[model samples]
Target chain A: MKKVMSVLLIGLLSACASDTTKPTATAEDRSAAPAAAASAAVTSAVTNPNLNPILTDPKNILSKRSVYFDYDSYVVKNEYRSLVQAHAQYLRDNAGARVMLQGNADERGSREYNLALGQKRADSVRSAMTLSGAKESQIEAVSLGEEKPRATGHDEASWAENRRTDIRYQGE
Target chain B: MLMRSHQSSRHTLTLAFLLWLTSMPLQAALDIEIFGGGATQISIAITPFATEEKLKQSITAIVAADLQRTGLFRLVDSSGPALRDPRQIVYPDWKNRGADALLIGSTVMLPDGRVEIGFHLMDVAKQVQLFDHTITVPADRLRAVAHQIADIIYERLTGDVGVFSSRIAYVMKQGNKYALQVADADGFNAQSIIEYGEPIISPAWSPDGTQIAYVSFENKKPVVYVQTLATRARKAVANFKGSNSAPAWSPDGKKLAVVLSLQGGSQIFLINADGSGLQRLSQSSGIDTEPNFSPDGQSIIFTSDRGGSPQIYRMLVAGVASGTAERLTFEGSYNVSPHHSRDGKSFTFVHRNGARFNVAVQDLATRQVQLLTDSRFDESPSPAPNDRMILYATEVKGRGILAVVSSDGKTRQELSMQAGDIREPAWGPLPRVR
Candidate 1:
């Protein structure tokens, strides 16, 4: 776990700048598939297992799926930058990988408004990932709103957990 | 702290529950627990109709419960003399029993099996008849006929149009399955219109009460669909590249104002009822959703964050393409889900300050804001057709349930199912003059 953290820190420091840029799916960028680089990453994923794994290891940042938000906010915070960048790099490394970003809100405000807020949260994460090197077409953003809650309590701690965008790869 | 006032009779309560289940595919019935009443309730007594015991349902029992649910009418002892002929009755007897008004009816079973109800409403002080009516309906329509009687009494006494005969649509989620349901305003005779595995929200009844438009995530994305209530036929009215939700029917019922993210931000758009002629209505930089058409159909009030924080804004229908927007709410930094009242005088919405979100109503002319509920979490403030009540969803004991707060914020009632969460309540318009 310590070794993985040190390696992720170096990767974060190098790619942090691009992670904050606005994601523009340009025509040239659409054609640039990075197929050769992906094949190499896939080979190393089997032999080395650092760049990509099945995501069961708790030490791997990719294992953390949720990006929580403050009340009535959709901005991706600075704390989750490394976590998002790790998954973005994983998506960039694996071409066939498809991801779904399900946004959610606490049980506050109108359901429709919360749904839109949830979508914005999911879109925020999608923008961060696509800008960090993930393909724009690889991610699908949707909102669960407050329908599904991680914790059903009405306290702040439960509401904090519910206001999130979950990153679920295809299948799992 | 809200008090739970159960019905006066337990038998009628069971039948109401049975009626709700008999209409649907046998699910849990939403038990209504009334809380607060009007400042001065109208004391009225509904006596058992002569020969009503011969029928399957007691007309007086159904009528009594409907009146009691409003919290505006107090049901007095009705075991007094009940007669179809009012000339033989003594009005002073009811006055001595602490009753200001009296309702008496008699049931006539026709040979062909239809039932005819002849009822009379009498004022104890005036000693004169207020309303007299004779209604004939099929045997299966006993509940409907009972509700109609309640409506007539409500309108005559309160001067406000009665909503007892109308229905309400909401989303009920049980375990993994979610169902869009429609029920009578009193929370009886519920029937599921659409059932799916995914989440459903924002049910807007068409102006005519014949159809409903809602957002369903069955396709894994929010898409607006309009379903006809009669034949159960439906079509996707808005399925754009991105999220399509927050459907509001125009007063004319020809077009729908919806929120879409087609241009990268949630903006208001107009589409025909049959899902044609899509036109963008409101153009805003920040998020703009939850559009509600005014009663006159001239403008719309929607929730927008263009002014830095979420607030309610009103814009003309013609001005949205390229015109100015008017902000309606200024009391709070967070306000959304604005719903116009039937008279178009005021709008009800969710107002949040700090962490407390409450249902609030604001006058369109005066702009005076009044928070209706002090509950922790409240949403979806849908006013009754007569503007006498506002139905919304709030959290009680960490469970999602529907609440009805009086327009003045005095009376409140909680409607909850035996299990599962009930949310997104949209009150239907008055049942067409029938």
Candidate 2:
């Protein structure tokens, strides 16, 4: 009976300790590791070409179709080197083609701040396209802060897709 | 006995630690359980001299009404003290009547048709005088004199400066047309500033209080525009291709911060006052919006969801080039729309918890969060230049209404028009002349 009572007391004490323990697991440190691994896997499966929305879509023949930017950055994530090259090549192929890059903030921030973030996103896309092949006179950029949400729900899934710039060709 | 002594020692040590903990200043953390009790039971006694009954009755009632409208004090019936002189205030009589505060005054008519008014604040509990002052004004201006005195007494008790004289600017949308209206802080004195047949969003005031920057959808796409308050001159700041919105002015009036999304994503950028010398600030993949400069002009605090959720982030002015950023808010899943206090001591923002949205303020020194508004959906809390009052948009009667509340969240008063719905109010800075 004494041995059983001691074991029960130990079990209760351990349960209490676990309940009062401060969290050792944080969202970033835990979720970030898995997200990075998944992203790496995705990149490996799909090499550079398929991810280039500009090169594959012939609709982008005017160099005004797609703008590229850097990773984890809206300042024109730079890996779109060839993708921007294709757009610049298109702009060279068809001169006098004008496009506007609309930057959009995901529904993850205050509308005012998101508006500014979207502007920077658009500016980055314009810079990359201009550097690759598009002319400064042919491209315009603007930002729409989280006011116009592509996805209505407030979740990570929706937010990830909303932080982007749209390329609109000014069909004359 | 020895075991008992050991236990007693342990108890003493624990008691000592508790005392030390209590002595330390509680970090500004607040667990606010708001009481929705609509009104206060403050009763003020006004006893006037016999000769000035007509002027006293009208003036005192106006003063009492103003105090009552604030929902901070109550004016009690004091007809029993009729004909009492201001000099002969019986503090005990007011104390016996269960009065928290008493206002007694007398007016002396001058030969030149002017009047001299003397007022006193009697502390019923302490059975002594709290404050007293005398003013000389024309007899016709007696009501204004009474309001001035009420303003004085209100300021003394409440540490916050009064906003009884300030104004609010809001956008009222009716069908396809939108109008910019400015009115007294009390929703009176409504006057239209501009009326357009299209959508107008995000009205921002210049530091000098002479110009307003807004986004107008006149050309079928969002474009940034600025209008002068005096000449009504309108100029397009930027008409970029994709989106041009969310205009903010720096404190020095030299630069304007706007969101331009010509790139593939939206980011914060700075442009010269004339819309030149544009520079990009944030490079995060997540959407960053609502950029506001700290009063000191050293850093910018903006809303960013780069970390997978919307939160307030701080970056130095140099961060535009250096690319260094730090997260400022960690509590609650949602903390957005940050407006810094004029003194730089605190900032006001809206924090969302589940389905409920609240207007909250954060103390920079203590890192304490205080919710000022309690409603279903509250947004766009703009602080007065005094940093004592915040005007925000809230839902009422199934429509959006503009409401103002004190910074401490103790006194809340709704500012609305009986004619139409009003939302997205931006409290202008203190008048430069005033």
Candidate 3:
């Protein structure tokens, strides 16, 4: 009788240890699953293998806030694709998060024309966000035209800085 | 500043009396200062007018100032003797003084409280009388008479219609107060047409010089309003959702082409003068605004970014059924705010070249573009009624001021005020003489 009782006690202790160790192993995978899923859904292209820090670290790719364009062009360049894709993944991981994409232009054209150009640029960024996994309602795109220039200058370097799409988080 | 205030008070008193007598608002006379002139200006001499009784204003001084302000004529020293008659023979002396033309005049007060004025224009080289005219008017019409004489002499000499008798409407902002003011073409006799605390922009004169269309930002958003000069009666022509701005009058004064953002993006639309018929003139996913009607009223020119960059495009007024627009400007990546010349032969617009914005005109036939200004921020180019000069807004010492450039780009002048920033000057049509 004493041997049978000791056997039952050992069996129950092993079951408790297995249950505790299982959750500890799965916690890391749970934290990483959303970002992995988001990347997989966006494109079949190779992505950064170490995305955990990129998604959470303030000094990582997610911290980059602006996408710039060439003169009179709205096409997003290849250099900014990974940066935008990381942001898209972040937004998809956190559904409650909202962002505002403000498009700006250099003071080279008419006020109304600049306003339209800025709108197109913001829209282009919004399109990329939605295609990556973000919800349409989570983003708002607006144009500031040449009215709100980041660089108050009349040169190519200043203009290149002024013409940009800025991503802003909620309440910012 | 003190002198200007004193002059303005005196001008107000004069205008009040003139309004009571003629039942019309006499334009506030402006004082003009010439900045630059052509390389070879016509040299002319005008002797002091002989008057029986001491006149209030000097006829010779008024005429000389008017001609001098045009930058087309240089007033030679007429300090010799007052010649009331052209018969005073001193032809060799005047010719040797580098005088291409000479003018002499006289003013006589009649017994019935009227005045008789006579003037003569003569060719100094030919020693021939070019014009001799006499006019009788009320005692108060002396300034008007002088301007008419100046116009006649200017036309007879330069073969171009004078703008001395015309007026200009502009918005003057002092602190938070804005005044849509009309002054003489020389920037004198400024009288406020409307006063508001909000901003006023895009002042456009009707074809008949009796009305003005402008954008007012009173209700937190821009609204287009047309106000008659005589009655001061105003009606909001466009108060749609978003913004309504940049009003341009049709040639017949029957319609207005305006910019509205009713459907999310700025686009040009045409509204009847009475504010009834609303029709969209431009349809583009991109922004299309700043529409000016052609002289013939058969077509409209506006700035659009449909082709990825801002460019001037022309379309028929027959509506969107007339698909597509013919691009008019391709010299630069940015061209906007086009104003058609009175003759429809060319249009002036703001062009961007290497980050500098300047006024440029393109001839429709020759496809040649001429840069009219070299300023860094010149905009809102409005041609004079005679198309002899282009009035535009520019920044001087960080203050907005109006400037005029001759159509040939030879002469330039700045019309600045003692206080406040003035912008969006629309040169009105010539006043019809009764």
- Candidate of highest TM-score: 1
lDDT of 3 by residue, A23-109 (tens): 111122434442454334334432334334544457788878899999878888889888888878888998766565767788664
Q: For candidate 3, what is the interface RMSD?
A: 27.9
Clashing pairs in 3: B28-B189, B29-B188, B29-B189, B30-B187, B30-B188, B30-B189
lDDT of 2 at B305: 79
* Per-residue error (Å), model 2, residue B429: 2.7
Tens-place lDDT per residue, model 2, B1-434, is 00000011111222322232233233112111112223444545655433555452345544554454454564444655443344566667776655788877777778887888777777767757788887888876665566577666677655556555556778777654467776655455566666654456778888877888877654334667777777656666655445667788889978877765544455678877677677888777656667788887888887877787678888887735434678878888878888888888888888996777789999877889887766777888888866766888876766667876756676665655665657768887655542
- The order of the candidates by lDDT, greatest first, is 1, 3, 2
Predicted complex 3: CAPRI docking category: incorrect
The true-structure Cα RMSD of candidate 3 reads: 19.2
lDDT by residue for model 1 (B320-398), tens: 3843699999886899889998899999999996788899999999999998888788888899888888888887777
Query: What TM-score would candidate 1 get against the native?
Result: 0.80
List ranges where model 2 is wrong by over 4 Å: A1-110, A113-172, B1-93, B97-100, B103-150, B238-242, B262-264, B274-277, B432-434
Sort order, TM-score high to low: 1, 3, 2
- Scored by DockQ, the top model is 1
TM-score of chain A of 3: 0.66
